[model samples]
Target: MNKFKKSKEIKKIKKIHFMLFFIAFIIFIFLSFQNEEDILKKLDENVTFESIHYTGTLEIIRNNNKIIKTFECWAKNDLFLIIFKNPEDNGVKYLKKDGNLYVYFPSADDVLTISKSMMKQGFMGSDISNEDITRNRKLLDDYSIVSFNKIIEKDNIFYELTLQAKTKDVPYFMQKLIINSDFVAIKTEQYDLAKRLVKTIIVDEIKKFGSRYYPVKVTIQDGIKTSYKTIFSITDVSFNIPIDPKIFTIQNLYNK
Candidate 1:
């Protein structure tokens, strides 16, 4: 009888240990999936927009000098309009509509329809490509996430992802992005067809209004001289604002 009681107690203890192990395994799996989803969701949220309006300055450094051009920009879906406010380039406007981009020059009194080849050119003499900002493509929709790796450095943890374009229409062929917990992209590297690093965009400042966080300041560096860096800073911004019907039309762009 004593032996039987000892055997029963040993079995009860073993069962409890098995149950605890199983629960731990389940918890680990749940946490792993939840983190993966969060990583993807934050990256996807950046490219999705309804309508946005921002007044900002575009500082283009060329010939060892920084040229500051102030402007107001409006974007809705894939359409965009940029109107310059600087004295020299004042009243100059760029409009993107129906998969085409057009620039209206007040001085020339002429509207030049930008071609596909021109998309690779600098936007308003800045390091930013016209294709980069005017393309209505979302990162998650146009690219496949190759790897989502969480890295720990010192006290902060950052999420990094390698993205490959799903279609040729996408802006960048390959991209590597590192973002922090606040869903702010700290660093982004753009690659070309040869997998060569083409451009690097670094976010310097981020501002939160209501429920959304926006990059208020960013610096862009291309495959150029160190003094050729371009800085973009926003003064004021609002999301999903009401827009006039004629604001996006080509006719409005000409008269604008």
Candidate 2:
């Protein structure tokens, strides 16, 4: 009788330990899924904007020479217009509407369409590409998260995501995005289908606009040619502002 009682007590204790372990395992799985979902939500909020108006300064460095250009840009949803404000490029307009990119030259009074093949080419001889300027699609729109991990450095926390392109229309086949606690991507690495790194973009400085944080200073570098780089600075910016829809139309591009 004494032996039987001891055996029963040991079994009960073992069962309790197993139940505790199972509960902990379930909580861990739930938190894993929850963290991924929360991070995605934060990322979407960081990049989504109703309307954005900004003045940009591009400092393009090639070999040893530097060129400076300025432009005023307005974007609403999938439509955007970039008008060069510099003396040399004044009146040059780039418009993206209905998924097509068009360039308007005031001198010739002509509108030229940009082919998809040229999307990867440098924009205005800078490290940034035409697609980089006109792409308003969200990351999740064209990519699926293959894997992700949370990283803690000192007091800062970051989430690193490996994204695989879901559609062929995207510029990069694979991308690595490192986002900070604010859900802003601090660094992005673009890779080709061959798994070769093509480009890297880093947010050097960020600024707070109202209640939101935005990258005011960015550096883009060519992975193939390390000597080539571009520093893009947002001189002034306004987000979620009212913008005229007609401003994004091709007809408006030809105007003035």
Candidate 3:
């Protein structure tokens, strides 16, 4: 009788342990699924602004805070028309389409297509690149969210979103975007195929243009080059203005 009682007690303990483990496993799966669902909801929310036009002056600085380049930019939708206004490269025009880019030199009167390998290269010795300027923001159309979380910056008020490329042709296979409640992209990190950090862009000096806020200044840093910093400042801005579609074409580069 004593042996039988001891055996029964051991069986009860084993049963309890099994039940506890099963409960924990269920909770873990539930939480993981919930987190994924929340991220998808956030990404699906409306975040686009009304159609607008903007013009700004960009200043580029290199290592040692030396002024390296400057340009005047006119932009609408995903297209930007730039004229190098300083360092004797003025009146040049460039066009970015999808992930491809082209530059037209007035002196040569020729338009040259930029190679895909050169997309990561600096634009006219500035910190900005073809990818940075031509990044498509139609999140719902181009990419999908894999995960998202809030990141506390200096003020402890910011949100960071991580997105995985849905297609193989995307310029950067993985991307992390940081934005505030206002849907302004304060910072963005790009990753390559090996999941290595390639570039980081910081947007600051936000100002309200019309009813929406826009970043007036931006700084881009390459992880491979720690000492390099490219600062772009917007000196003038206009929003919600009319822009002709022809302005986005290469032929319109020379149009006032």
Highest lDDT among the candidates is held by which one?
2
Candidate 1's residue-wise lDDT over 109-161, tens digit each?
88899998899999989999988877655566787777788888897889898
* Best-first order by lDDT: 2, 1, 3
TM-score, predicted candidate 2 vs. hidden true structure? 0.86
TM-score of each: 0.82, 0.86, 0.70
Residue 171 error, candidate 1, Å: 3.2
Clashing pairs in 1: none
Q: What does candidate 3's lDDT look like per residue over 1-256, in tens digits?
A: 9999999999999999999999989998778756544543443332234334444455554456666456666566566667777657877877765556879888888788888788877777766777666775555455676776766778765667787888876777788887775556778898887999877889877876555666778877876877777777767566646767677787776554
Best by TM-score: 2
Local distance difference test values of all predictions, in order: 0.83, 0.89, 0.69
What's the distance in Å from true for residue 159, model 2? 1.6
lDDT of 2 by residue, 138-255 (tens): 7777888888889999989999999999988888999998999888889999999998999999999988777677889999999999999999998778898999897888878777
At residue 47, give the lDDT of candidate 2.
68
Which runs in model 1 stand beyond 4 Å of their true positions? 1-38
Q: Compared to the true structure, candidate 3 yields what TM-score? A: 0.70
Clashing pairs in 2: none
